[model samples]
Target: MNGSPASLDAAAMTNASVEVVRDVVYGHGLVHRARPGGPVPRALKLDLYLPARHAHTAPRPALIMAFGGAFHRGSKENDAFEAEGGNTSVADYCLRFARRGYVACAIDYRLVTEDPEPGTTPVVSAPERIPTSRTDVVRRIMNLPPATPDMLWRGIEAASDDMAEAVRFVRSRAAEWHVDPARIALGGFSAGARTALNVAFGEKVPVAAVVALSGFMDRADLQRHLSGFDGGPAVLLVSAENDLDYIAEATPGLVAQLRAAGLHCELLDVPGAGHFYQADAVAVHDAHGATTVERAMAGFLRRTLGG
Candidate 1:
């Protein structure tokens, strides 16, 4: 979706009263053309948030957060989840980091279905066809897919390129945002997480660290190559017991590979949580109650981005 202020302002205001308790911060959203690609034929844009009271130094640590929608659909806006007190959007998380003294940017990347070829039937049909019991309609939307291995690989590459461009774009305009260029890290969920891992683990781009919530690294060979790079970004992988996706099973192996390659990696498997921890209302209740994901993410940022 468009990251226009009008589009996000209401959500932000609706969530304003929802206090995260740990930190208080302010964030702003800007739409910048990071690259020119896809059928849209326009500059791909992303939203950035800065910590409260942050002053631009020569270099400031930053975090690039990406959301997941199975590589076919997703927006920075998708992180909005309703809780008892108020709502928590991905923007809120970005603001939290900004409050803690880090520049956080949630990005919008091109997805597979952005402009599907005319008359070509999609590999995965409508969400209603999936028999999942989750009531979240968004999850149903994520069920549609480019199911083939080739399509999956292509999506991964496109997203990786988009992410690389975003990193470069942020650093390129660091002066304008009062951000430090050297300490940028990356975070994403599911497919977005996959993109983060692929890019961070790939040779094409270099980041300080990567935080993945239920994401796996593609192209094992490329991951091995990343392992050999000295001081490559540290990685944090978070998953839950109820995760039915390949990520839960795959992360351990990826962690092993990264460690074998001499890269620092940390994994957190939340007990009884599912594919998307926020998928179920009760799970959301439990996750929020424990502050499991947020706590881990905060700790990770403090170490990796110096927030």
Candidate 2:
């Protein structure tokens, strides 16, 4: 308050501090605290990584990150849901944004498993079925409950719906959170990536950009919640060249759709990487797997949402 006009102007131009803090809570109308110890769902909360008070005096662009678990198991810590440092985004991958002075949030979404009477087996084809499709690939490897074409799709729809509300939730607290209501971006890995795509193309929300890491969605499914509006937001898609899921389907179609709709979109192929780059390919590729994608993400956010 007692600085020269020149000094104050400089301070305003550049964020003066890098201090980081976190706030977590359920979104509006999403708070459902279960009775003391009843299988409460994983806390429907997001951890925010914020900069210093001075830096946030003006609204800052925000990013909401969803983790990928093939639509059944990822979390805010999707980068390492089962390994150490898997609970909070502040400790793992999402924390990288704090240095850049952007408020980043890692969110967890509802994951529902198909239910069937125990010991009552699922109907199997006359011949032992060879699994196919991205869902089938993940289902076999993860040993998850038997899923039908219908169930897996329902899962994606549910996750994307939550993402739409999460954007609204962040804007609802724009003043308190110091986040620019108009500059929010969405991105995620694996299944989370699919949800991000759905959030931008599948429905209407005030989104500036989208970053998808190894994710995809069907046009018809995305059409289920379409809200006619202005031009769509920019999008970036990243997938492993070896990812059985999209090397042939999804990404190609998605890129075509974005272009046909007159929207800007980019796709980066991660060579030698699998579906889960952080978990499976980082070490083998000497960090190119994750670093390249993160760099692309930073560049995309900067170009589309600005600081």
Candidate 3:
């Protein structure tokens, strides 16, 4: 036996071990789009947070988290601010989902490039000065870039398109991403929720389920793109009752349509909260019960994607 210990080899140690992927695997998978004279040929960068191997192994269910900023801008990270607050970063969801036995991705999508010209109309945020119209809420959706109807519409479409690409990218790398293609799902908050719904309906892709936080889809929009995909997937709808407009105007009819169309739809409503339950969860959790949103969402995922 040698008296001296064997010399350590730094290269050998580095080569033998897999790179420790803590936090997330970022800017890896890509989705490409070719637009005529488009400013950017490549769009969207994605991040994946993997859970413990034993907890969630190969062919795991995957969910895509989209951020909301009135469709203009957002980070792919969960820590990306949720104006409504309760967000612990979409990455948190990915990590937690991975822990609970799933693979999750936070993907980027293109936003409306055109911001309204400054001073064309003075921006007003004061409670008294604010418009009491539907456009007002839409305007507030984005922190930057004064949005108009057309810009917002394009923003929604662009974001939805890129998200679809993300989904397709996941499916294309199903083996690499360790995802079960059949169980893919989409979820988002507010504007992001709208994007999620748009992806669910606008594209012809097959997803096992959807988790929409404070959002809904128009039946007409769904029908418009019905030819692209076949079959209806279950949906988990979460909302705060304090948002009267959503409760009185949208949710009831949306739920009815979901049931009428034979889609499994579950609605979780917080009786005393406002428009941004997620934000409230982050900033004023006790009053809003923001964490509950994740609990119910996880439960739904466990049931829907557990298989």
Candidate 4:
């Protein structure tokens, strides 16, 4: 809202227009044990949502929506903000899935803090400065990490392990949530997108598909590893031309490599858009207006994950 377009607020949210009711699964937001050597301790939590009335179906698809905040900041609760409430909200997204007959889960992963103090600003011990010319400031602020590949890898590894554990935790308890363990999908915005991509391509876990929104994917070793990895899940790279310079540059090459590896991939390039389209309809308007981008994303999700 501060740095993004003003049009997003006034633009019509078509998804909000739909008439859908959902029953949320509350109190299920509990932490699961993390893999050894990951960032946060073994106590990381996630929230799950399913069509309250439709839990009897078999093999129902599930979505794991990871909130973006550069991996340093953000919570699964952020997805419930009033401005982005309703259809754009993660709850709404999952509810839409439930309405369409799928289950959705949103997870909160570990933030990159050396000594995280609750309710205090997280200070990242990284060489990179805030508001840099080389990186997207918002992303940098959210995913504040040391300016080195090793640090990034460590953060990502921790996140991947947490995410993997989350998937397994959900799968292990699939009967309770009425979800199909084999049909789980991973998706996130920005840094969360990177985590999703890493988990989907990495050998640590098995994901059916990946939906990376305004994501960055330029780790050569990770790319190389994914290139050789067999049976990796499909990917949907969603972004606008104006999303972020680094993400824009890295995604195409990643897509090319994934395709070469015989993996299923699709790139949805929105016009005139920047990062955080869901929260700001003005930015969505700036890019190609809200209707177009929302429909595109909704359609892409439906097509890739099934309606």
Candidate 5:
């Protein structure tokens, strides 16, 4: 909440609106984990939200987002299940950003496939059937009742690759979309945050910044995969005061590790919230005025991206 002031007034953009271009295919990639038969590529898509026509004459900054679902269930379209007015979904974030004269995208990525039933045929026998994993963040991380450390790593890698692809896809279409490719940032909630961090640090893609909400990688993973990480984007790490126990436990170490890598990182410890909330439900005061998640994010983007 405390840094460079917001570039725009948060309250004045109430009447702003945006247009959505949905189901646009960006590329194809294999799912988070290999199926019974082998790897199969799936279409990667995104819903682009552009500032309404005439909203701007020059290229605008872009924000590419990935939704959180523990790398299991969820889509580029929706977010944590809840009603926070227009503050709840991924599309909502896109709409808000587009209204403020920025291009935004909600992207698709591979998810884990459900285990085959005992004595039942697997996915290769029925490619048309949908595959799923009802696993949640807690289950995946703790490996509580069942151990799945390997599966967790594979899913994170797969999802991170897909997110990296999304960044590349947006950059490829920068001219057509009137986007400033160098200013693009990556963000996500919960599991999506984990994926975003992975892409920003692990991938070679050079994003301008990153906003991770209630998400982070394990300390060991950070040391193992990102020890050689060099210059990368500035980062804003948001942790819900009441976030999952494990995420809270890992945050300090994560922040320390990021800083140790010579990266400029800031932590926003959001009070009175958990893993998810309405976009504006939580507010913070900057020099500009009281700002919500939407405005804080916009401000961070503007400051880091120089929009």
Candidate 6:
């Protein structure tokens, strides 16, 4: 943990005192395609991590996160270092934030390849109207590989909807969780980060802040969305120096666009790192001295969510 913040170390990253409630269903709906037998409702679930009860008496701020697997394969419990037999899963992030007095949730969304039936729509909130022109622009900005042939736009849309529902669900349970509804934030990595951006800017979910890692959006669309924006949620746009080409190219532009729109946006580029660093793997040199990705993320949440 070179250049690590004094408050952060490997030993203190995952707080054992945190309470995690796994597989908590947040939304229920039909799959995009029917199963072998018939169309059975799919329950969208999340793992909720609550901080240890303390005498400090303020409702905890909350974070709702989504996992990334290119919108096709991922789990709320997927450990970033599973191949190495390590226990650094999204739950580690949740636990770290929980210990700092924030309620954290890692959620599941409908994957692109979940059920491949044509013309079958899943039950979701009223679809947010996305202009065809905007979709075309986003496709160009993404610059995905030529090998995959399914509809990428559809997956992005569906995932964003699921994230919005998660936000609403957490807000609804604010009292039971002893959280502050107005202090909730959204975050994710890779594809999940893209989903968080969609919910924040596209779906217009009233969240306090957004933390997007290795993710970006069309600069033109971002500016368009920020038209007449009176100080929207603060944004932390993070990416690796060696991230995927498209992400490396677009992240800086998006950060510039957000700042030009007079919004509070920060950028953290992890030098010599790639797109898939674990929560605490990459270290960043910031005002707080040497900081890991998890530390940077937690600090951002605290600043924007009043933790």
- lDDT of all the models against the reference? 0.59, 0.60, 0.59, 0.57, 0.69, 0.70
- Deviating ranges (above 4 Å) for candidate 1: 1-40, 55-59, 80-89, 115-146, 222-224, 278-291
| Candidate 5 lDDT score at position 184 | 90
- Name the weakest run of 10 consecutive residues (lDDT summed) in model 4: 116-125
- Model 5, global lDDT: 0.69
What lDDT does model 3 reach?
A: 0.59
Question: lDDT per residue, candidate 5, 1-40, as tens digits?
Answer: 1111242224333445665667778877764243566555
TM-score of each: 0.70, 0.72, 0.71, 0.69, 0.78, 0.78
How would you encode candidate 6's per-residue C-alpha lDDT over 118-234 as one tens digit per residue?
Answer: 233222222243222323433444563322334555666678788888999999888778889889889887778888888888777789899887776766667666776666788
lDDT digits (tens) for residues 1-307 of candidate 2: 1122343223223644443333355542221233443333343456555565634268888888888766666556434543322222223445566557676777766654522111111111111221236556557778865676555544555576667767877788777768887888887876677778767765566688887777666554443433354588888877676675443366777777677767878777766655545422332122234446567677778888887
TM-score of 6: 0.78
lDDT of 1: 0.59
Model 5 C-alpha RMSD to native: 9.6
* Stronger candidate by TM-score (1 vs 6): 6
Error of 4 at 64 (Å): 0.6
Error of 3 at 127 (Å): 27
Report the lDDT of model 4 for residue 277: 61
Alpha carbon lDDT at 69, candidate 6: 66
Instruction: Name the best candidate (by lDDT).
Output: 6
Can you give the lDDT of residue 30 in candidate 4?
Answer: 23
Query: What local lDDT does model 4 show for residue 209?
Result: 83
Backbone clashes in model 1, listed as residue pairs: 51-98, 59-180, 60-180
Error of 4 at 54 (Å): 2.6
For each predicted model, how many residue pairs clash, with residues at least 3 apart or on different chains? 3, 0, 11, 7, 0, 0
Candidate 2 ranges beyond 4 A from true positions: 1-23, 28-43, 54-56, 81-91, 114-134, 137-143, 220-229, 278-291
Clashes of 4: 7
